[model samples]
Target: MRNLVILGAGTAGTMMANHLISKLPKKEWKITIVDQYETHYYQPGFLFLPFDIYTTKQVKKKGSKFIPKDVRYIQEKIELIEPEKNVVQLEKSGELAYDILIVATGTKIAPEEIDGMAGPEWYKSIFDFYTYEGAKALRNKLREWEGGKLVVHITEMPIKCPVAPLEFAFLADSYFKNKGMRDKVDITYVTPLGGAFTKPKATKALHHLLEEKGIKEVTDFNIERVDYENKKIIDYADIEIEYDLLVTVPTNIGDALIERSGMGDDLNFVPTDKATLQTKDYENIFAIGDATNLPASKAGSVAHFEAEILEENILRYIKGEPLKAEFDGHANCFIETGGGKALLIDFNYNHEPVEGTFPFPGIGPLNLLKESRMNHMGKMAFRWIYWNMLIKGISIPFVSAKMSEKGKHLEETV
Candidate 1:
C-alpha cells in the first residue's frame, strides 16, 4: 500500500478525507491527516460571536470527530515539507513519506506584522474577532464598557471573509440601537478599498445601506502604524483616525512552514494553477481553500465547490491521465446587515453579483444581491447545513459545482 498524506484537517482537508475514503481503494491507498491543533472551529460562526449570537460551544469541536475512522489522524506540528523527496518533517513525531500530498493549511491573522499592533494596548483597546480568544475578549469589553468612538477597520485586503468588517459595523449599529445607546456611540468604518465592497453592484448597494445606518465610511486609507498611546491609526499619507474602541482585521498570511519549505509565494500561499489547484512547482502537491494563491474569495463556499473538481483531478493523476482544469472560482457568501436582515451574493470568475433569485428561477426562498429577512433566515440555517451536510462530503442539492446562468440576471455592459 502507498501512503497519501494530507496536511491540516481544516474544512478543505476534512471534506477531502471523506470524499477520498469512499472513492479510493482501501487496499491500495493508506491515507493519513496531520494537524497541530485539536479543535475545529466553525469559522463563519466567528462573525456572530462578538454580537453574543453564538457561544463558544457552538463554534468548536474536536478535530478527530469529523475525521473518518478508516483514515489515520495524527496530531503534530509540521516543521518542513521536502517536496523534492516527498517527505514531511514533524516537530514532535518523526518524518513521513508520501506518494501524494494535499496541502490544505489555511491562512491566519498576524497582528504582530504591524508595528505597535501587538504592543501594550493589544488586547486592551485593540481587538480582533478573527481568533477565538480575541472574539471572547471583545464580547466582554462590549458588554460592560460605555460606547464612544467605535471604529471597525480592515488593516489590509486578501483577509479571511472580506466582508466581515462591514458586517461588524452593521451589527454594531443594531447592537447599540438595541442597547438604547445609539446616541452615545459614534460608529465609523475604515477600509483600504475604494468602496464598501470589492464588487461594483454589491458595493453600490452596501454603500446605500451604510448611508442609511449613519455609519461613516473612510476609504482608500492604507494603514502605516498603530498609535497605541494616543489611540490613533496613521495611514501612509499622514492621515490619522482616532478611536476609543478599535475592532480590526489584521494582516493575514499563510503558515510559516510554507515559507520554510520554499513552496509558497510572497504571502506564503502556494503558487497554484488557478483552475487545477495543482502547485506550479510540484505536480505531486495540490492546494485548496485559503492555501492557494487563487484569485478567489478566501471563503468556505469556494472550497466546497473546488473539492469535487480536486477529487476528480487527483484520481486522474493516480491513473497517469491528464488532469482536468474544472475549477471556475465559484464563491457565495451571506452579508449580515443587522436588524434581522441580510444579503446574499453569488458569482464566479467572469461575473459580478446582480439582482436575482437563488437555487431556483423566479422561485427562490432567498433573494440575491438584495436585503431581506428571508436572507437572514438562510444565513442562520447555513450553520445546520454546514455541520450535517457539507463536512460529510455531501453535495448541496440543486447547486452545481460550476456557476449557472439559469436564475441569475446579468448586468448590462457598456
Candidate 2:
C-alpha cells in the first residue's frame, strides 16, 4: 500500500488528514500524522485569554479528538526529514517512509531571537499572547495592573494571524474601559510596518481606529533590542519606548525539522508554489498554511482556503495529471475595534480590501471594510466554526477557495 505521511497536527495538517482520508482509497493507501503536542490550542482565542474573554479550558482540546480514527496519530517530536530518501526520522518512533508527504508543521515564535526578550522580565513585565502559557500568564498580569503605559509591540512580521496584535490592542482598550481604567492606561502600538497593516486600504481604516481609540501609533520602527534593565525597547534609530507592561509579538519561524530537512527557505518555511501550494523543488511534497513561504496572511482562513485547492491538486498528482495553479491568496479577517463593534476585510493577491457586503453582493448580513455589531458577533462565533467545521475539513457554505469580486468596490485600490 502507498503510505502518506503528514507532519504536525495543527489546523492545516489536521484538515489535510481529514480531507485525504475521505478521498484517497483506504485499501490502497495508509495515512499517518505526527506531532509532539497532545493538546490543540484554539490559537485565535489566545487574543481574548488575557482579557478574560476566553478561559483556558475554553480554548484547549485534545489533538486526537479532532483527528479521524481512520488516520494513525503518532505523538512524537520529529528529528529530521530525509526528503530525498522519502523518509522521516522521529525522536521516539523509528523511521517512517511515505509515498506522499505534507509539511504543515507551522511557525513558532522565537522570543530569544531578540536580545533580552526572554530575560529578567519574561512573564513579568515582558509577555506574549502567541502561546497558551504566555496568554495565561499575561492574564494574571493584566488583572492586577491598575493602570500604566501598556506597550503592544511587534518584533517582526510574518507572524501567525497578522491582525492578532492589533486585535489585542483593541481588546485591551475595551478591557481597560470596562474596568474603568481606560483613562489611566496609556496604550501604544509599535510596529515595523510603514502603516498599521500590510494592505493599504485596511491600514488606512485601522489607522483611524487607532487614533480614535487614543492608542499612540509608532510606525517604521525596526526593533533592535529590548533594554530589560531599563524596561525599554530601543529601535534601530535609537528611539526608546518605555512600558510598565510589554506585550510583544516576536519573530516567527517554521519547524526545526524543516531546517534539518534542507528543503526550506532561510526562515525554514518550505518553498511552495504561490498558486498551487506544491513544494517548488519536490514533486511529491506539498506545503500549506504558515509552513509555506507564501506572501499571504498566515491566518486560519488562508489554510482553510488552501486545503480545498490542495485536496484537488493531490488527487491530480496521484492520477499523474498536471496540477492547477488556483490559489488566489484569498484572505478574510475580522478586526476587533473595541466595544461591541468589529470590521471585516476580504481581498485576494491583487485586490486590496474594499467596502461592500460579504458572502452576498450589496446585501450582506456581514459588512466588509466597516465596523458593525454583527461583525463583532461573527468574530465571537468563529471559534465554534473553527472547531466544528474548519479542522474537520468541512467546506464552508458560500465560501470559495478563490476570492470573488462580487462584493467589493474595485475603484478604491490604494
Candidate 3:
C-alpha cells in the first residue's frame, strides 16, 4: 500500500483526511496523520472564551476522538519536512516517507515578533485573545477590572479570523453595558489598515457599526513597539496610544517546520498554487488552510470551502488529469455586532460583501451583510456544526463550495 501522510490534524488536515478516506481506493492507499498535541481546539471559540460565552472544556477535545480508526494517528512533534526527499522527520518516529504529502500546519500568533509586546506586561496589562492561554488570562483580568481605557488592536493583517479583534471591541461594549460600567470604559480600535476591514464595502458597514457602539478608531497606525512601562504602544511615526488594557492580535505566521524545510515564504507560509492547493515546488505536495499563502481570508469557512476544492484537485492529480482551477476564494463570516445580533458577509475574489439573503435566494432565514438575530443564532450554532458536521467532512446543507451570486444585491466597483 502507498503511504499518504498529512501534517497537522487541525481543522483543515482532519477534514482532508475524512474527505479522502471515502474517496481513495482503500486497499491501494494507507492514510496517516500527524500532530504534536492530543487536543484539537475550536480556535474560533477562542474569541468567545474571554467573554465567558464558551468554557475551556467547550473549546477543546481529544484529537484522536475525531480521527478515523482506519487511519494511522501519530502523536509526535514534526521536526522538519524534507520536501525534496518527500520525507518528513519526526522527533521520535524518525523519517516518514510519503507518496503524497498534505501540509495543514496552519498559522499561529507570533507575539514575540513584536518588540516589548510579549515583555514584562504580557498576560498582565498586555494580552492576546488568539490563544487559549491568552483568552483565559484576559477573562480573569476582566473579571475584577474596573473600567478604563481598553484598546483592541491588530498588530498586522493576514491574521486568523481577521474580524475577531473588532468583534472583541463590540462585545466589550455590550459586556460593559451589562456590567453597568459602560460609562467608565473607554474603548478604542487600532489597526494597521486605513479602514475597519480589508474589503471596501464591508469596511464602510463596519465603520458605521463601530461609530454606533461609540468605539474610537485609529487607522494607518503601524506599530513600532510597545512601551510596557508607560502602558502605551508607539507607532512608526512616534504616535502613541496609551491603554489600561491592551488586547492585541500579534503577527500571524505559519509553522516553523515550513521554515526548517526551506519551502516557505518570509512569514513561513508555503507558497502553493492558489487555485489547485498544490505546492508550487512539488505536485505531490498540497497545502490547505492558513499554511498556504492564499489571498483568501484566513478563516475556518475559507478552509471548509478550500477542502472541497482541494479533494477534487488531489483526486485529479492522482488520476493524471489536468487540475481544474475552480477555487474562487469563496469565504463567508458572521461578524458579531454585540447585543444578540450579527452581520453575515459572503464574498469571493471578484466580489465584496453586500446585503442579501444566504443559502436561500430571496427566502433566507439568514440575511447577508445585514444585522439580524437569526445570524447571531447561526453563529452560536456553528460550534455544534464544527464538531459534528464540519471537521467530519460532512457537507453542509444548502451551502455549496463555490459562492452563489444570485441571492446577493451586487454593486459595481468604482
**For each candidate, what is the lDDT?**
0.90, 0.93, 0.93
Clash pairs, candidate 3, are none
Indicate the residue-level lDDT of 368 in model 3: 90
TM-score for each candidate, following the candidate numbering = 0.98, 0.99, 0.99
Please, what are the lDDT tens digits per residue for candidate 3 over residues 342-378? 9999988888898899989999989998899999999
> To one decimal, what is the Cα RMSD in angstroms of model 2 from the true structure?
1.0
Off by over 4 Å in 3: 412-414
Model 2: lDDT equals 0.93
The TM-score between candidate 1 and the true structure equals 0.98
What lDDT would candidate 1 get against the real structure? 0.90
Report the poorest 10 consecutive residues by lDDT, candidate 3: 405-414
Candidate 1 lDDT over residue span 198-220, tens digit each: 88888999999999999999999
Give the clashing pairs for model 2. none
